[model samples]
Target: MKKVICFLAVLITFVAAFQLFRQKEGVENESYTINLRHNKSYHDETDELIYKGLLWSFSQVGATLPKKTTARGIEKVTDTLWRIDVSKLGFRPVVLEKWRRIIAAAKNTQEYHLYGSIMLNRFVICSIYASNHYYEMVQAPKTYSEFLHPSVNASSKAEYAVEISSVSKGERLIRMDTTVEAITAQQFIAVEGSGHFSQGNFKEELFELIDMMPNGQLRYLIYSHNGRLVNASPNSYGDAGKPAKCMWCHESYLLDNFMSTPNIKGYLNYEQFVSLNKRNNDKLIKYRKQLSTEINYENKKDHELAEIMYISYMEPSAETLAFEWHLSIEEIRRHLAKLRTHQHHEFPFLGQLYDRHEVDKLAPHKSVPIPKSIREPNDDEPNLLGAN
Candidate 1:
């Protein structure tokens, strides 16, 4: 009888231990999810786990694929690398095949699980893969007159010439167009004339984007002069994509800091540039007032998009974080040590990096009221803050 009792007790203990192990595993899995729903607060982590499975899926996929970029367009540069032409409005079979692998692997993450079907219908049905909705807008008209802005009727073309970029100080012609009916329909294209080329003599390394969504929130995109989506800007150093590089410097949707140099051959004089820009600015603000009924456009500054991308993708070092948050390195380290960490596919290969979702919760609101100052003063930025 005592032997029977002992056997029963052992079985009970084993079952309890098994249950405990499952509970612990569930908690660990939950920590890695990043909830990116638009309406939810940035601080809100308690929403139902919209994304499932381990974050390591992204790393696993990144390991298998060719490095993201090769040459600017669909140039068969190498055996493994092929560039995508954004203007074509469809992924080549080879490019689609590569992104298919990524999408299949990403199916487990929230990026795929929740958004996959939606983006697939929105972008995939249209033929773009591996990118967001704005990728479709690359094929949109490049010039202001081509877009047929209401203001363009008053002038044959709504292009305004500014000085050759005091920001980048590059000898490239810079022209801006901000003339669409509503803020959401607005688009901006700043072309860097043939004065500059990338390492391999790539020409016209300009930035183009449609700046707002239908809801009036900002969206930024970067494309090569050939009208292909590109990760790097010809003017900038690192290969930060889309809004990351663009938003890193812009505090507002439209920056009011285009200085004119009349002596420069192609650009408009100071007075003409200022007067036209103010009129453009006033119209954009009026459009935003129209959108205020449905969207809180002012809640997010353009620079926060940069910060979100930095935290998510960069796995920043202590020094970088210190500068970003206006905190000391030691303090940054302390905060990092407390947060949950993940193995980021891109970097911090030696060890796991802090999870951005958790890190975001620590400072529920913007850590600082003001935007971070530009780290490099003379970087090749032709447009200071451009809105569409």
Candidate 2:
């Protein structure tokens, strides 16, 4: 019985030793698992650290894909768009926007045009663009539209047009008429006196004529028959249209129908000022009252029919005036009325002097410290504040 008792004690001691061994190993395995999980989502060693009590970290995905691969000293990875090879530690990253491959995504932070403005093909480029970049297109840099009053558009380019109907039937004659200088309907002008005339699908012919013409210059006339048109001025007697105040057309000089004005006031050249003062000043001052004089607003009986006026052509002599841009008839009338009122005075109901072609002859608005000494002795100070 004593011997049996001794064996049982030995067995108990062995069982105790085995239990102790298993407990130690289990604790060691559990510690290893905790370490792996803790470090699994970390970047810096501190992220996996026990710290004083808790971990302090910045990145949530401490051990993320791209970053983690790079950290592991990986060699190469190939994808359809990218070939990432980290075996070579010193491989350069792509830094250009136009580069075919993207090595990294760069965060852009900028305001307007200096660095990351992202203004490609803006107004400084073409007169028109996608709606996103439409305002930035290149054209006459004005604050208003010469044609559409109380509204604003860039001046340098004529608006693109696609006629829906025929000019002969008076359905849609004005094909691509956007020039502010074109006051009377889509009447064509004569540059060198040999104005082009054609009909039908004639885009190719027009281009041919353009090729045959000089740089930035083309003279053409529309082929319109008499009495068929309404309130549309024709290039010739054969192209005469109807009358103003006619039942068929809408011809009213309402204020809001105008274009919006710009902030900086456009300037006129000395020559323009002199010419305007000599020839058109008195007549223009009396203009607003006679806006309808240029058109036939009379004859209440026949007013039901459209009346077309033949806006005569009068080119400025090279020696007479130097205009930086082309002038519209509407703008000319405004300036004459505003004369002596101050060139810098902005019209709330109107656009800037920039709408006038004369402004084109002068430099763009700049904060020049204009010397007071240049002021003419008889005239008011040669300068006035155009805008705030």
What TM-score, over all chains together, does every model reach? 0.41, 0.15
lDDT score, candidate 2, position 339: 34
lDDT of each: 0.38, 0.21
* Best by the lDDT measure: 1
- Write the residue-wise lDDT of candidate 1 on 1-388 in tens digits: 9999999999999999999999996554333221221211123312121111111111111111122421221233233222233212133444334344333333344333533221111112112211221232223334434443455443433444433454444434334553444555555555554443322232445654545543333445555655655433544523333343454444335554444433443345556656755665676666666642312334443224323323332344454445444478689888778665565453333244554335545541231111121221222222211212
Q: Which stretches of candidate 2 lie over 4 Å from their true place?
A: 1-157, 166-201, 204-302, 305-388
lDDT of 2 by residue, 1-388 (tens): 9999999999999999999999996654332111111111112222212211111000000101233333332211221011212222221222111111111111121212122221111111111111111111111112211212332234532221222222221212111223423222222211111222223332211110000011111111111122111112332322222211111222221111012222221323234324432332233223323432111223222211111000000112121112211245455444444332222232221112222123223323221121111111111121122211
Candidate that scores best on TM-score: 1
lDDT of 2 at 162: 20
